[model samples]
Target: MSAHPTRTDTLVIGGGVIGTSIACHLAEAGVGTVLLERGTIGSGSSAATAGVVRTYFPGSPLTGSLAVRSLAAYHSFADRTGTPLGLERVGFLVLFTEERQVEDFRREHAAQRAARVKVELVTAAEAARLNPLLDERSVLAAAWSPEAYACDPAAIVRGYAAAAQEAGAVLLTDTPVTGIDPDGRVRTPTGDILAESVVCAAGPWSTAVAALGDVHLPVSADPIELLLTDPPDTPPATLPMTLHADSGLRIRAWRDRVLVGMGRPGPDESRQAWLGRLSRLLGTVYPALDGIRVHRGWSGALEASPDGGALIGRHPSRPFFYAAGFSGQGLCQAPAAGEIVRDLLAGKQPWTDPAGLSADRFPAVAPSLR
Candidate 1:
């Protein structure tokens, strides 16, 4: 440890949704916490998020369970912390264009129901009834979950930060951690911070951040683009967030306008070109938005694990823990991820089993920079 080290019970790296949420939970648990962010809070991948909160994952019990727990937390966030979650439960719709897809959803639906999740499997006509903009002719079936909601990504980050601060957690923005060791020493620009334990919740940068401590995290970064289009002729405030599973496109109401998300498999050659192509797909999904001009578009990095699920748990042999690799569902699982981190540090069993999220699931390999 450096001279005059800033000591803390727990030192959290990153200020995005996951880190802030963990800080809030740790501080609320009476832990002496310090959170460091290389830049402003929610300025990384979180700022570019569409903020869609849905509890729908196929063949992913860990992610689904976490989303369910996190959704419950979001539902009571404002009341618990006095910071509004800005949640809008307009519902979520997952569309299937073929019978096979419907069958897949049916299996997943049964699994969700077994886990006590509330969901409805609807036909194309019923789906159209929920969102009149839907092109009933193109849809075969859909899964609707009325408990799904959306919120301001930045607001959630700020709310968690506020709650953390209120509970005596120290937040340091623009303070980048230069290095870290397995011994729980964080080297930053200002000075070293000695902590009993450290957490890496740096969103897409988790792998790189963990490397500073000679710990390899199997995480990859994927660039995602989001386009906000001009308000429709008649805004539908009650419109459910719609997902075209076949085309890998999603759309949700954003105030008077609409927010669109595109999941491109590989690197994007051009954002404008990509957005243009995705816009066309949106038109196919909902002919009502044909030729609708896009108002703005932006791109951000999303982290992923080999299994396409979040990595949350303690490192192999270090006084360190991590919560990352959330792919694109970080917002929906942040609350539960925070609770898991807190429970791990406290040596208490979490209410929900996190077996699938253990870091040991993947090999200890360094993340490659593409």
Candidate 2:
């Protein structure tokens, strides 16, 4: 017997949050869509995300705008589809340690306010009061954004995928796309899929996916280390997800335990070594978590764009399109990106100009996916 035909108006080549979100939007709009995942949806870096949702990019106006617009979609997600986004409104706090950093914090607060985010500058004491675990002596000032939240990244992916499936989109988990042609022909193990358009949202493997279409995406793999502590007696619900700007460390509530992440300077160290360093850092900052037993830890890959903004638009040279290069903010921007891709496919004017995010901005320096 012949294999069943697998064709779609648009073939999305990843099942992460961004790809799934795009599938949901396109299928909901009555466009035939198919999503293929090498593994289960959200099984990659999306599963390892911190899921800190906040519209507080200080110097990045475009990124900040996209985040704000996406937040609206997340806020209404559950109401529209009856699937919870797993959002925890624990708030977000950015603690500044240096006196000079105070001005920068103020600037970010002003920009956030301009973006209509409910935010303010709080004194160190007030910051400590907000989260008792905060080290007042180590903090000079903080930007308190009450509207920020923490969420389950996997939940968001499942929600998006479920919605997409409900809208008639075909989701083939564990189905990997081996190759693609510029003519929108996708090669897979079971069969070939001829599509009118193909979207590359393969996350860390996005560069490789682009190469399949003879396109180059200026995306780099960014590995991040995160440590999760054993469940404590009382869940630290009062503690807002805190970013220690000076030390490049962030701590947040996760389940009945806490999740700690160390950013920058040592991305190549072993997990054990990173955890040791994290323990020392915690001792110096939030003494409350000093002796917390680190039950588990792992490193995950995130993609970075040259400009720290997501690459979202049509391919300049082929019948392909893309939505990658999120630079560790994919979850935060997935909702709006879905809409952006749908608008591009439908020939409608996007709410935001995607000219700045086009992949053609950089030279076509294609690299080996091997």
Candidate 3:
């Protein structure tokens, strides 16, 4: 007799950190699961990320609390999964050159304090102590979020994949879910999968899969690039990830290299131009690295939601659910986001209030946050 075809209770598309984290959480909750990926695990944004896990988001629902919990959950993932996860504890240093923005930072800091974020406002004098390389020419105060941190995004995904596999979850890399049927069924590149529920975690490409449900995932893709240098023997001991206010510069130190990114500049410029802009920004912000050469470079695309947050909840029309459009901040929010989805699917308590992140939050015929 022929064996019955493989079937799972749930199907998760996109095997990046988000997808794998969701799959692993569901499996741990005793949900039968199968995760499909278009490429090898961690090949997407998850791998290309510099992994800046900071807790300074302004919004209420997902910005601050989700980050704190997610940071803690990463530790749990590493401990439970037996993987060498890079859970670094470097804090964040955000500087403002404009006086008006410094006031805005104070309000943000106040909100963070209300939200119980371990962050504080510091004077330009204190900021200089942390890194003399800071652009003192543009004098202003800075905010320091001591609880903020970063991790090796690639290692986190790998840990989740390994744990999910150990928990009896089937992981299929290099296979894509081309379609989703109305009856909770998934059509893959090679075969059909009948699942009770499907979780769409396809980062930048989520819309392509969610469209089958008459759901318009308004998220586009744009590549963010970065360059690194040789490791500094005495790395900025705690060279916190610094994000410049007006300049849109994001910087961090790892191993021996300073990994920096120029926040998603408009998509009009050429890739090489983007690289040049970042190089100049880094050089300008830290003159010490002026002649310091770039040893390597990488680019990763991200999806954004209209509200600048992630969509994490059940589909309004479909009984079974999905989540997408993390909007560039998904790396740090993946754990709590996945847990909320997993809980909702399992009918658990403490629901994820996704009103702000509703798909309807977009403008009329909304544009994706690429």
Candidate 1 lDDT, 193-252, residue by residue in tens: 889999999988988898898777788988777778888887775789888878778888
Return the top candidate by lDDT.
1
lDDT (Cα, tens digit) per residue for candidate 2, span 302-334: 799888889998865555779999988898899
Candidate structures ordered by TM-score, highest first: 1, 2, 3
Candidate 1 weakest ten by summed lDDT: 361-370
Which is better, 1 or 2, measured by lDDT? 1
Candidate RMSDs in order? 3.2, 3.1, 3.5
State which candidate has the highest TM-score. 1
lDDT of 2: 0.81
Tens digits of per-residue lDDT, candidate 3, 1-370, equal 1122257898888899889989989888888889889889989877777677866764343467777778778767657888766666777887877788777766566667765577777888777676666766655888787776676777778888888878878898878777777887787667888888888889888887788655677677766767676664456666887878777677787666788777655658776676677778777778777666675567788777666777776665565466777777888788888788887787675344655555656666334321
Per-residue lDDT value at 275 in model 3: 62
Model 2 lDDT-worst window of ten: 361-370
Model 3: CA > 4 A from native:
1-6, 58-61, 230-235, 264-268, 349-352, 363-370
With candidate 2 superimposed using the best TM-score fit, by how many Å does residue 350's alpha carbon deviate from the native?
0.8
Off by over 4 Å in 1: 1-5, 265-273, 363-370
What's the TM-score of every candidate structure? 0.93, 0.90, 0.89
Clashing pairs in 2: none
